[model samples]
Target chain A: MTIDARADRVTLAAVAAEARVSISTVSKVLNGRADVSEATRERVEGLLGRHGYRRRTSPSSAAPLIELVFHELDTIWAMELIRGVEDVAREASASVVLTESGTRHAPGPEWLEGVLQRRPLGVVLVFSSLPAGVKDQLRSRAIPFAVVDPAGDPDPDVPSVGSANWSGGLAATRHLLELGHRRIAMITGPEDMMCSLARLDGYRSAMSNAGHGVDPTLVRFGDFHVQGGHDIATELLALPADRRPTAIFAGSDLQALGVLEAARRQGLRVPEDLSVVGYDDVAVARWSSPALTTVHQPLRNMAQEAARLVLRAREGASVSTRMDLATSLVVRNSTARLVEPTEA
Target chain B: MTIDARADRVTLAAVAAEARVSISTVSKVLNGRADVSEATRERVEGLLGRHGYRRRTSPSSAAPLIELVFHELDTIWAMELIRGVEDVAREASASVVLTESGTRHAPGPEWLEGVLQRRPLGVVLVFSSLPAGVKDQLRSRAIPFAVVDPAGDPDPDVPSVGSANWSGGLAATRHLLELGHRRIAMITGPEDMMCSLARLDGYRSAMSNAGHGVDPTLVRFGDFHVQGGHDIATELLALPADRRPTAIFAGSDLQALGVLEAARRQGLRVPEDLSVVGYDDVAVARWSSPALTTVHQPLRNMAQEAARLVLRAREGASVSTRMDLATSLVVRNSTARLVEPTEA
Candidate 1:
């Protein structure tokens, strides 16, 4: 892993040229020289910090570092994304630095400022949005950044990588419909997120295509967490037996697990009494009891693409700004044909 | 989220004093001035980089950064640790920078050098070993670091925080013994890890106390992964009926899931045909089929303590070098009373 020595040299030279002073003058500011005028000292210091210029004593070193920002770092889903990004970073001989945005969508100004001082070669925002101010700051610093599964439809100029959530949701719902489930329910992520809306739209399309008009009452919005799934599933399951849905399409595998837990509490066996289909075939999906039948969204591939795009951009290459990976259905034991009611 | 401004001022002042030159001369060297003598320039430059002298233009800023190093970033277990550290960091107004060591026990020299250049307030290493050379470098630079679940017993001077693994293992095995499981099997982590050895020792002690000598063939060493548990359990289940164990204790919840998978493939019902116990009652333990009866290691608490220890050390406070949090048994559905065989 060789450090980007050329980048350091370029930054030092640029700082010197920008300040219209000898390289030594900028170095003096870094060393806290009192001889330089206060105005000149401040200007050189600003450029030095902004460009992250440091003394390059060694030539061969670790690869350039890339910053990966996450809204939160508690879920296994984030782990999958981290694994994917690390895979690409390793191949590129780069290191990855992970930081939580300390908020749900936009990073705080303080976080952005620290990032600027560190001067990562590029940045990858996972399930996060780039605030306009941050975008401007990064652009001004000449730092490349890309988004992975942006929470909203990103601006056209912002590069991003995501999966076909609409298609995945459609396939998941279609799987349940083909299993002879009519009174089916859908549990989706936060209603405000674009991906969540896309998935819900897909579910609606599949139901309507199958001649079953959309039932708004049967759709519940969740926070893409287990508790969210559990709470909603509990309410749905508590409905009158005759009106209860025989199948469920959970937005994520974690939610699917929660649904399975709800079924267990209600004394209903999976597949036999209630069929479930999930999204994002994370590792735990295979280990899940009865195994999860889910839409296989390539989380790792999406992360890799995000990392690749940012690295490419850093290299001054012209690359597509948007990438949507394919999603497929994985048949497993979680879904089955709904048994017809026996004659009384 | 105030930055450690005092530390930055002290570093610059210390460098100037140590160089035995006017502060302006040191500044000239920092600015890359050609007029400075080569000998003076070399001495000042070395001190500047080593001390991490950065200009402090802001009085109030984001908290100092802390680095958290992991051997790999693939497991939910790692995520739990991250969450714990992040909790403490957030309270301290510190931001965490996460990095993967790319190796199992030791972070490479290049990675360490980069970390030094970043000049983090402190470092928390999860499941990693500190090489003597690296330790010396960190000490010489006055950077404080603490280990969380160190790969091995660390030097007395090195602070660390870990769980009571032996007690947890003993409690888990005792729970199975109390349920009349005489022929019990143990699936532990790698033989090289100190925690693994402690767990295996606890298992052995329990068996001996019960007057049941351990069967060497029933003990398996794994890598603390799902497949490790699965493969070992498969081999154990393949034995002749009379030789098969009635209960098994897996070192981790992930391994227990594999054991469950193995039992399922063999058409055995949990707690009826085979009782099992697992360690590390992670979130998945509650949602596993029949739920998992395991030991709770307080992983999050352990992480919080590690972060706290490093921070306390950074504040020039004297503290204990080692901490072992308590672990307890969490009885769930995976274990039950063994049914006596009826005479044919």
Candidate 2:
């Protein structure tokens, strides 16, 4: 076993020479090109593996890297998405670079410039809208991108991943209705967002199906934050006793926490006086006092699927342009049977 | 006033020509160099600002970027750090690139390679250790770096930012003692971390000063996570009623939440049967049940200071090797006056 002085620094060219193949043939084999003969592929692969030869550090051969852009990284919801994407990225030997667009709706010009300079293999955006120019720019560069919970109705050509928001809303509302509650109030996310609209539609549909007309006065819009929920809830709870609702459906767990605070300030007891249902069963939901009953949005799974879809798009593989994972209702201690007014 | 043909695109050369300066002089202004005359500097700056002539897209003149590496991005604590760094980076016209080291102690080889290839202006690491070889590699490249809440005692030469852990721990312990809690338990972070050890030392010192010998059995080491706190708290709470501590001081707010859960499971009333004190007054602390009374470790301020320090170091400015921000105790509803066993 004589060792060549250059043995330590293995190269694709050396592997090609040892395998008695052209550099192109070796490259084809490494890339899983069907043109390479099975015998030739095996020989090249064996030599490459034995010599510890990795793909050359070229633009086309480098390990793929993906970028995840978020409006902000302050919430547990964002953390769940990051975890999901990282899980998929790790399995593919890919890297995830995180950036904040510095705006809620869309990234600014500076962010776009920075992203273009990085030239990532793909991009996954969370709660963001893509401007027409930005879309054209990404297309021009042949960079695949997918959105997780897009801010609005995404272009038909754009790929997106989200949960069944409409179904989640219906399930939550129906649960409250089954517990003998007619005066139910709803708090939804930003009205412009597709998910928010869909969830609101579901709530309306459920109410209609139950033979109860939707009361516009009982419905409020929130920014999907605790403070927003708290402010809106404070307004709702301040209604005269005869007009007050017995149950509230919050748009997010953070908002539901705000509702809880409002109820606490009014000296109202959860489940006993004011039943509550929250969306997005984030980790803290379980730790919340009385343990929130929420709709499980499968945020992590949505992110995982979005990552997979972008990777597939990058590989020129056919994938669905839109994906909606399932959402389910989680019954916890927050909701209980409503008592009659006469009982009080 | 005629618009130039290249008005849409501003160049450094145009700014130099307008200001009657050389290209190198304009470059010095953009890079914040000190050699240029004050009069020349003002004229060039005004022209650059008016024309919006950013530096040319060269390796040396490119926009500044800072890389923030975290062991994991799953915790609210990590989000707080990211928020702080982003706040400073935004003001400095610098972009933040986020990467997970993928290991608890240090980054893997691939992460290091990727970071070096990006050629960032500086680097900020959160709860990560830097190996000697890695440190040397960064130093050789003249890339400045700083750590936030470093895992252990970093090299004296390594710049770092942290909270005053000893004072925070001492204040928390002293508060519990003032409430007449003779038997108190402490839950600190991992044993090897400098911050954890410092906090533990503070607890010991407080106990010694109060003329009570520190009980070795009452101290437990946690991983600075909710589950770790839960498991350790469960064990501590399971002790015979006569032997169990009347109060528990947690190293972090997440741990305090777990302690609350453990007490809840044991049918113990917080601040009545058990008093709890937590560190790191993260946002969630105010939302937790009983609104946790904890020491406020200025995590965001620490991060902001670290970012500022790295930026200064990159400019070839002298800076302190280590910086510690102040921590204070925030009294809330989680703690109360301890009642005697006879009263109970």
Candidate 3:
């Protein structure tokens, strides 16, 4: 894509003239640095109105370079995903920009159009569920892009690269089963997300394959956040002691941490009293109190693949769009063999 | 900026035709996507070579609309920093494009030039330490940008925002001192970095104010990483018992984790035998075993302020420069009072 040379159409002189203030004051107000008086800031803002010196809107050759878009940044899951995207973009000889969709706090479309108009060689969507219309728009514009851990049913046509969530779920559950856990409960991410659904399905299939019926009551839905895990675990704890499951499986590491906290608050010791397992062995998992047992997604590999996908799409590849990588379970101290409950 | 109305530019189709491949495959190669057999990909490369279709390097009316430029995204510090920048940019009514200077891995003028040429309205330097000459180049362009936690004594003229590191360090050290620990040691960040220096200054000043001579041997330098903390702590543990400080202060949360691991490997009980305090109380701090007693920098707040600075700078605010926000200490179980040798 060509750069828009005249992007910086709005000049400081224009803003200063419109604002009726010294250029320095206006600049200070803009920068929010100390030294600008309140009255001057307001006056400058008014002048900005009269002069119509809006920040550059349309992508010009002068506009900033490509941006890396994230659905949410607070979650630990996004950390590795982001690092992966950055690593690949760095190697590809491209500059990286960052933005978040805020699916967790609120859902809306703001950055998508701006990103589309920029005509970046490609974009990386981190663990985001792109709206159907937005996806169609990208397709029509032929904007090369890729999504990591897309949260929905797999669409055979869209190019995506991520780990096998379903298989990861199965691996997590199977590990518990192998250690003699018969009654296993699960905490899953939001229903709309593909990874969450796949993981839940994995849990179910593993139980079924082991000749056991999945208990609907034992499964709880969470928002894939720490608080969600805490809330779900608290709900699980409210059940009578006799009905409590022998093991708990969390969909994400943050959720597993919440589970640990919930168990701790209830005076239950990890592994000794309650066996817990988590997904996404983030850096925190290794140092947590019990050193969580988890399933590790090939984060770096997925990021590299996603970057490659977007770059390829930008280069023009009319091919099937989907990638499902594998996951491996790590045996940590969080899980132990099932022990028969002593009769009170 | 007004949208350039220029139409008839050479499209991907033209390049594909020149390369003698489907338009899709050419798109893939240019965008850097994978899937075409190596032979076809190489052939496409040769075709682009034979036919001088230089991929639209010149500036034109229709500039790429958005860009995402980052200082570096390879480090965990940079990754979180980008997340916040990305989140705010999406909400600020503009699309983003991603770019990086890769300053840590490759610090050169050529790298800086590529980013500036993109001409984004604003750029977010993710925990950047821009070389002196590069800053001048950016200033000459009058490009509006923001830096996060700049490395050394930040220039007062540039508009950047970050948590108050001096206060953060002071708070961390104060907490350890208040816990009745007299002999405290420190593991600091990169020596040249302003934040590291400020933190060290805070640590020293705190001890001096409390009638303690700053022991030079008790202090160590690390690169603000996990292994750095681990290595330093291991070395500290090898010292004679009387020489080893009873309490330790680590510069960053990542490094603190390494220190924790070292303590564990040495069979040192947290609080009972030793105390630790860390800075930049990242999210992981809360869940870490013994829960890191550290200082918290409002990362989200710092990010939001930086975005505001850039937006204001874009609005013709000539008065732009550095910003220093405040920080607080978060007390946890990682630290305890100092006990006499015979007390136990």
Which candidate comes out best when scored by DockQ?
1
| Fnat value of model 2 | 0.28
**Cα lDDT tens digits for candidate 1, B35-62:** 7787886687678767756544331222
TM-score of each: 0.76, 0.74, 0.70
Cα lDDT tens digits for candidate 2, B254-310: 889889878877878787889999989988788776678999988888889889888
Docking class of 2: incorrect
lDDT of each: 0.78, 0.79, 0.68
Q: Write one digit per residue (lDDT tens) for candidate 2, span A62-82.
A: 334678888877766877888
Candidate 3 - CAPRI tier? Answer: acceptable
Query: Per-residue lDDT of A209-289 in model 1, one digit per residue for the tens?
Result: 999986677898888777678788989999988778899899988889889878877878787889988888987788877
DockQ of all models, two decimals each: 0.31, 0.21, 0.23
Cα miss at A326, model 1 (Å)?
2.1
> What is the Cα-based lDDT of residue B207 in candidate 1?
91
lDDT of 1: 0.78
Each prediction's RMSD over C-alphas, in Å, is 8.5, 16.2, 14.0
